[model samples]
Target chain A: MKRSNIAKLIIALLLAFAGYAAFFIAPDEATMHAIQRIFYFHASSGWAAMEGTAIVFFANIAYLRKRTPKWDWLAVSSVEVSLAFWSVVLVTGPIWAHPVWGVWWAWDWRLTLTLVLWILYVCYLILRGLIEDPERRAAASAIFGIFIFVGVPIDYLSIRIWRTQHPQPVLFGGGGMDPRMKAVFFFCSGVLTLLMIILICQRYRLEQLKYEAEELRIAIEERGEPQITQRAKVKV
Target chain B: MDAARAASIILRKEVRAEMRTRELLQTTVTFVVIVVVLFSFAFEPSAAEARRYGPGLLWIALLFAGSLMLNPSFAKEQANDTIYALRMAPVSAFSIYLGKMLANLLFLAITEAILLPVFAVLYNVSLWPVIGRLAIILLLGAFGLAVTGTVFSAVATQARMREMLLPLLVLPILIPLMIAAVEATDELLEASPVLDRTWLMVLVAFDIIYFAAAWMLSDYLLEE
Candidate 1:
């Protein structure tokens, strides 16, 4: 099969499975009732975000060491996609919080830290949008990517040290999670990883197209006005 | 050789400009005093809670007021495209950063210095010992802020709406530092027996880490 077909298949399967699991596979927790089911996707999206962001961070270190555009492109794609999935986790978290916590937000450490992460990524996106030079954009973003990774430790400690609805999974034995909970948690994590890969592929393709378009734009600017339609720019 | 000369020139120019009018300090301190006074309206003028909360409150007000001062601190440079001009002048970007960071640090320090005394009087606490400990914390904490704000000012220098972006970018990371500083201040204020010398030492460590990180990474950020 073509790579496109395989990518599309993976994306579809992950989304379908995630939707199915949300209503069917996952059981409501003993404490939180039906609202607790959101935890599956919430935790999964959060996991995917952390996992994908680690890729971006490592890719940034590679780019800075190598001074390669390709690595920078990869890092940007990974972060943008990670931001999208993390956005899902952030929004759904509040939905879950409203039902359980009896309020939309408290200055609880997990919630506050999550909001901080959300704002940081939003600033990341805003930074990308504001820069016109590719080299400066990559350089600035790499600097920020490295600088801001400090928050990851803070986010981790915020939950373990504070009372929060944010569940800590027993991955490396934080605590022994139940057998059934472990199964659902791992399943959600698996589905989300597949989803992250698909988004990364899509975003990387878009980056390549963007590079081509910039080349075309530079050529046109060097020459004269070309016969390009208004609709074409919109499509781009 | 010549760059050092230019750097000193930049530093002197900033110091002279600040000393001539004391505009930055005057504005920041005045704003902080008002903010503290406003706090009294919000939380009745009681003594006990005020003394308990006063240290954190002063620091919080100073942090916000410092950023308010920071936003315009580089305005003159950005307005005339002087940053580009400065870049052209063969001076190291690090020197330019040091000049700006020092200016901001002084402005924040002045504001913090004034506010601490006023906060003590208002809250009715014997503030000399508290002020001494608090001074060390603010000095270290302000260095982190200055280094961070300087680096981000370069990033924000290129953006259309910097006022909006600077806080979003800086505050998330600054949260950890603020918590540490406030916790340290609280311990000093309450005379907590558990107040370890290690925590103040941690603030000093944070100042060093972020200061070095910002300086080393700034050339990358400032590249054309």
Candidate 2:
């Protein structure tokens, strides 16, 4: 716990430093001026979402192969975190769009795909809720996670081939970023990735605690002996 | 048993059962027709607008029709516990998935064929001139829908609110398929109709990738 607290403290400091760099240090853009500052958070959230989904995909495959609860815990944690990241994307995306694109939302390729992806992952979460059994839930969600992950590439390719009003990916050579801007962007992305890891770890701990409580209840019910304490029963 | 043989056997069983009752097919055809008519009323497109938007409208209707038809692909097996019996069979789980996907594909194809002339008449579009190109596009688009819809239908069959869950799970995943289908259909319906190879290729790729993934994942999906 002490080690985790120290790590958390380090992440918090890094995040504070990244925020300072993005706002006060990075050079102003030629166009879109102050509004473009949202890009730092927006792009980092997008990267976090992408990385989270990738973790879900791999952990899901591992759960299927090993049938381990740890993998299921990891998978669900990643999904929840990923959903939060993409929610940031969806909300911040429009804020970035309205001032620049002159519309609150455009049915452009990238925006539409992201919106669809958000809905698709929401379906994944809802599917998890609808299942009653824990193992069955894990298995089913793993299968669905694989399906959703596979669809992401096709979603991206479809948008890439059929371009619309969504801006091109300027981060990667579309228009090269200034070196200082690149430093800030990478700094923000690194901080967000660290934050995603911390969130998943904390969420995984909650799932672990729940699992332990469930095991304790099962043990108590099976024992059915006279010595069990009332407090233990109530807690269980 | 070989996967192909197992798949063909399941396919034959479904076809025979479906043919005997014609229940799913009849309902789906009627549903598609009603959807097309409802859309015509809802949009009330002019000739010029109809030619531009009719293809998209047709695909939207087909998606709804396909969802209704695919919903019971596995749910009926649950009623008689036949799915358990099928699980005990020697066939691979992928064969079961393939069988259902083929069945759904055929059902959607037949409904689309019926809806096509009706749509042409109602919308006052000339489909006969580009019927060949249109058919290919429909086949690819419907195949993609069947591949994803059948898998998701199985996923939804276990859910409490299944009918609602299937479309919620399917439509978003199928945006690319819908986009490509609508675009290809739009191109085919233009005044000087020409098929867009790029969109057709997208449809084809989507179908291939999803079909392969479904085939690989069906075993996991069908677990008890």
Candidate 3:
């Protein structure tokens, strides 16, 4: 069995366990009840998304400092995974919100900030696509990524200063959580973090494969030779 | 050359070139005026309604107009290969960024100066009472815009779809600035206005942070 397959299977099992714990074991909230179950996945995905972006931020910095293709790969992979998790956050957020807040979307700070963060990363990907040269694409995207990350705090602060319709932070809201619920929350977080790692690893491997493919294509184009397949096989 | 000296030299070069044409300024101001006029016709709001929503509308114009002004800042350098020349110079790359940023800031300030009175008259909002505070907010907000917009302009300059890409890259990143600027302007536009120190601080902090980030990371952005 492949190591990658093993990791994926482990992640899948953990996700299922987390979901079961969230829906079955965790006591229903006194107020929101069943729908609040979404909180487990929703909030955990949010944390994973943030973790993904934070990795992207560091990957960007490392790429600039070391100029390694691996750092660029890390940056791109993390952002792509982060986007997937952020989509989950966006989707699940509205699901939770609609039942509780009675609206599909809230213009509240965190929600709005997350939406904008998603946009910024999407633009980051677009910027990368627009540049043809790989080195330039990596460098340009790193700079843009740093700027986007810097803007995150500013976005948070602006929303904080100006009170909006969004609910206050519930995770650390200092409101005591039921002990079992807290356990479930941390359990969900742990599972999601593992999921994030698995996604990043898979994506990073995809990037490596892409780099190899590009190199093979370039070698074929330059030499007009049949060496590409053998080289690719050895690389794999 | 020293960073400040290099920056001033780039600033002077841009200003001199801009003065010769005034293309960016004229087009941006015209665009802004047309936008304001179109909004008036579209909404046709009463004086009270105008006063309420006017600041938001004004900043929207400024945001779009500032983007128009910034798009050309680096794109023009591409035409003459002047960017290459600047890159080859023995100056810190940050100097080039700061210089372009300063030039964009000046152009935006000029646009705002023209648009503010026009906005005041067109929207029937009195500007005299809040001019000082309004200037502060505009300066801070515009500084924020120019910092982020200038950097994005450089990145977008190399894109095939440079024109469309500039604003796409800029607007999302500038939301914090927009929030601070719009809310601060809203406070100033109120009948019983009190300048929100918090929003002002947000604007100032963002400007400083953004400018510093651009300065520090700029060397990587312009690489070939």
i-RMS for every candidate: 2.8, 1.1, 1.0
Clashing pairs in 2: none
* Candidates sorted on lDDT, descending: 3, 2, 1
Worst 10 residues of 1 chain A by lDDT: A154-163
> Across residues B83-188, which tens digit of lDDT does each residue of candidate 2 receive?
9988999888899889888888888899989899999999999899899989999999899999999998888877778888888788888888998899889988
lDDT of 1 at B220: 67
Tell how far residue B184 is off in model 1, in angstroms: 1.8
Give lDDT: candidate 2, residue B36. 84
Q: State model 3's lDDT.
A: 0.89
Per-residue CA lDDT of model 1 for A1-236, tens digit only, reads 99888878877887787678766776666788788777878888988988888988888778877887778888889988888887888789889888787877667766667677777777787877777888777777777777777546644453334335555554676975557666777888888888888789788878867876786787678768754565257535
Model 1 spans with C-alpha error above 4 angstroms: A18-36, A62-72, A94-108, A154-167, A178-180, A225-236, B2-10, B72-75, B88-91, B191-202
Q: On residues B1-224, what C-alpha lDDT tens digit does candidate 3 reach at each position? A: 78899999989988998999999889999999999999999999899999888988998999998877888888888898887888899988899998989999999999999998898899899999989989999999889889999998998887778888888888888888888888988988887998998888888889989888988988876777
Top candidate (lDDT): 3
Q: Please give the distance, in angstroms, between residue A5's alpha carbon in candidate 2 and its true position after superposition.
A: 2.1
* TM-score of each prediction: 0.84, 0.94, 0.96
In model 1, residue pairs whose N, Cα or C atoms come closer than 3 Å (at least 3 residues apart or on different chains), thus clashing, are none
lDDT score, residue A167, model 3? 58
Worst 10-residue stretch by lDDT in candidate 1 chain B? B191-200
Q: List, residue by residue over A1-236, the lDDT tens digit for candidate 2.
A: 69989999999999999999989889998888888888999989999999998999999999999998899999999999999999999999999899898988988887887888889889999998887778888988888889888877788878867768877777876987778888999999999999999999999998887876777677678887633455446533
